[model samples]
Target: MNPEKALVWFRRDLRDHDHAALSAALSNAGQVYCAFVFDTDILDALPSRQDRRVHFIRESLAELDTALRARGGGLIVRLGRAGEVIPGLARELGVASVYANRDYEPAAKTRDIAVAESLRAQGIAFHTRKDQAIFDGDEVLTQAGKPFSVFTPYKNAWLKRLTATDTAEWQCQGAFAPGPAEGIPPLEQIGFMPTDLDTIGIQPGMSGARALWDAFRAGRLARYAALRDYPAIKGVSYLSVHLRFGTISIRELARAALADESHAWLNELIWRDFYFMILDHFPRVVGHAFKPEYDAIRWAERPDWLAAWQQGRTGYPLVDAAMRQLNYSGWMHNRLRMVVASFLTKDLGLDWRLGERYFADQLNDFDLSANNGGWQWASSSGCDAQPYFRIFNPITQSEKFDPDGKFIRRYVPELAAVPNKYIHAPWLMGRLEQEAIGVVIGRDYPGPIVDHTQAREETLARYAVVKKTG
Candidate 1:
C-alpha cells in the first residue's frame, strides 16, 4: 500500500538522479513533494560567516531545485532547525510519510530520532534509507557477524561481499508536485556570505561533480596510484566535496573503481566506509582515542607552537606549505593531510583533537568520520593505525613528494627563491647562501620551531604511557 502523499527531505544527498530516498518516495508514494532545509542548527554553529561549504551547498541546492523543476517538481526550502522544520512541513503538506537519506553522525542520529518521534506523534511516518555509503552498519560484517575493527580484512570482506546490485541505481520515477514560486534563499538570508570558492577553482553541484569525474576518468584514473602522492600533480579525483554533500553517488564511484580495477582509488573509498563503520561502532572516538590506552598519553600545552603550526610558520617547508594551502583554499592534498597531522601530533606534541577540530572548521569537504579517523590514524591512536614511533620527517616528506619544491613555492612564496638543494630545509643553508637567495632564515621565512630529532624522541617517550597503561 503506497502513501497518498509523501515528502522527500533532502539532506546530504542533494542530487536528483540515483538517489535512494528520492527513489523510495517516488516508488512508494502516489504524490511526492521535495524539500530542503537550511538547517539553522548546523548553519548557526559555523565559526565563519564566509564558509566555502555553505557556499557550495547553496549553489548545489540551486541546481537541485532547477533539476527538480524540470522534472515537474521543485525544492521547498525552509530555514529552521530540521527537527522542527521537517515535521511542521510534513503536517503543512498533509503528507502521510516523510523520506530522507540516513546520516551516521551522532548528532544527526539524535536529530533524526527526535524528528521521527515528532512525525510519529502526528500520525506521519519518517523513513530513512542508506545513500551515503555502499555498505553501511552490519551490511558487510565478518563471518562472526560482528563489525571488523581492522581495515585490511574488512576491505577484503567488503570486496568479497560486493555484488552488481549494490552499485545499481535506485531509479526515481513517478510524478513530482511543484514547489512554491520562491526558490532557495540567498547566502545572506541563510546568515552566510560568499566565499572564495570561485577564485579557489571549485565548481559546485552535480555538474561540477560530473566535470571532475569526467576529467579524472579520462586522464588521471589510470595513473592515479602512481602520481597521487605528489601534491604538485593533478593525479587524484577532486570530488571529495561532492562526495561529502552527496552531489555525487558513492555507488557510482565504487562502480567506476571496480570496473577500471583502480585498486588505489578503490582502497581510498573503502577507507571512507571503514571510518564510517568505526564511527558507528565506537562513537567514543569522537573525542577519545579508538585504542583506549593511547588516551592515557599526555600531550604538551604549547600555545605558541600550536599557533605557529596553524599559521603555517612552522619553519618546516612541507608542513608550512600544507597548512598555508589549507588556510588559503580550504582544501589540502590527501598526502599533505597526513604530513601535517603527523607534524602536529608527533612533532608539535599537540593534541590530535586540536588538529581535527581545526580541519573540521577549515575543510570544504569536512566529513566527521574521515576527519576524525585520519587524525586518530596520524596520532597512532586508532584501530589499524601506524605505530607511534613512525613519525613523519617533514623535510624528507617534502623532498620525496615535492622534490622540486613546486607545491611549497606555490603556497609558501617566501621559499620561492630558495634553491632545490636547500628548499626542503632553508634553515640548513649557509648564511652566505641565504644572502645569495636574498632571504634570511628568521626574516623572510620562519625557522623550524622544533627539532625533528628532539621531537621524535619526545613523542616516543610520551607514547610510552600507552604501553605502560596496557
Candidate 2:
C-alpha cells in the first residue's frame, strides 16, 4: 500500500466495528489514526453540569479507546471546537486525508464544512461518509428530485429505494485491523473531567449495545408495538443514545429488524429514518414547522401553567406522570410523549416550542428531527400532523394506555391509594375519599393545573389565527 496515512475523525459514530469511515481510512491508507473532538461550541451552550449525554459519551469514548488500543491503535482525544481541533490534528499528524461521517444538524454541517476548508488549505482531503442515518437527505428524494414533506409518501419512497446494497455491512477486518499509527494524545489533557458514568448504571460501548439488542430480540421485540406505549414497561429498545452517537451501526440494527418477524420494532427504526429524511429535505423545520403558516397561530402563553407542566404538577395523572418521568430519567415512552405534548400545546395552550425545548433538554435520545416532528405533530402544525380540532383527553389517554394504572403508580405515587377507576382523575373524588387516600388535592399533590375541557376550547380559539393564513 501507499506510505501515506489517513485520519478518521470520529463524531457521533463512536464504534470500531462496522464503522464505514474508520474501515475506509484504515483500508486505503498505509497507517490509520482515529480521533474524537469534544466541541466546546456545543458544550458551552449546554446548561447542566451532570448532563447524561456528556457522561454517556465519556463512557462510550472510553470503550472505543479500549477497543482501538486492542487493535494497536488508540483514540486521539481533544477538547475544543471541532472545526479547529480536527484539521489541526490532521496537519500535525501529516495525514493525507481526514475521513468522517456526516452530521445532518445545521451547526454540525457548518462546523464540518469549516474543518474541511481548513484541512484543504494544507492539501489534506476531507471525506465525510453517511453513517448516522440509514437513509440521508437527498438519497431518498422524489423522482422529480423534490424533497418530501409528508411522511407516508416519504416512507413509501424510502422503502422503495432501499436495496440489499444499502443494508450490507462494511467488514472491518484484515488490512483495516493491521494496527493504528502511533502518537495519540492523553484523555486527561483534553480539559474534560473524568466522569463516573458506570455509577449511573448506563451500559456503554458497542458490546453494551449488542448485549441490549440481543436481549430485546429475545424477549421485547415481539410485544414492542403494543407494550411500547406504557412507560412502566421496558417496551423500547433503549438504544436511542447509542444510535444518537454512532456507538452502534444503523444498518446493523435495521438489517436485523428487517430479518426478524417483529415488524413493529423495525417500524420504530423506520420512523427514525422518516424524521431524519424530514430534516434533510427541509432544514427550515429545525426552528419552525414544516408548514411555516402554523407559526402564525397565536399561543395562549401562561408562564404559571408552563412552570406547573415542567414541574409535573399538571394534575392530569397521565400527563403529570409522563412529565415527572422525563424530569427524573431523561427518557419518556412514545405514548406519553404524544399525550404530554398534546396536553402542553392543546390543553395548556402553550407553544409547542416550549415543550420541544424541555424535551430537548431532558431526553437522552433527543434527535432534532424526531423531536421537532413529534412536537409539531402533536400541535397539528407539521406534515401528517393531528388535526387542530382533535385534542387528547388526558384522563382517557391514561385509562387507555395505562388502563390498570401500572405506569401511573410507578411515577405518581400520590395516586397510589386512588382506585384504578378514578386513578386518571383523582381530584374528581370526594373530599372524604381523598382524605381516606391520604393524599389531598392541591396539598399532598397538585390539583389539575388547567381544566382540560376549558383549555381545549381556549386552544381552538388560540389556533384560529392559523385559518387566516391557510
TM-score list, all predictions: 0.99, 0.95
Model 2, span 216-246: residue lDDT tens = 8788887787788777778888887788887
Q: List the residue pairs that clash in candidate 2.
A: 12-246, 13-246
* Model 2 error, position 367 (Å): 1.9
Backbone Cα, N, C clashes tallied per candidate: 0, 2
Model 1 over residues 295-359: C-alpha lDDT tens digits?
Answer: 89899999999999999999999999999999999899999999999999999999999999999
**Sequence-dependent TM-score of model 2:** 0.95
Stretches of candidate 2 off by over 4 Å are 174-200
Off by over 4 Å in 1: 1-3
Candidate 2 accuracy as lDDT: 0.82
RMSD of each: 1.0, 2.3
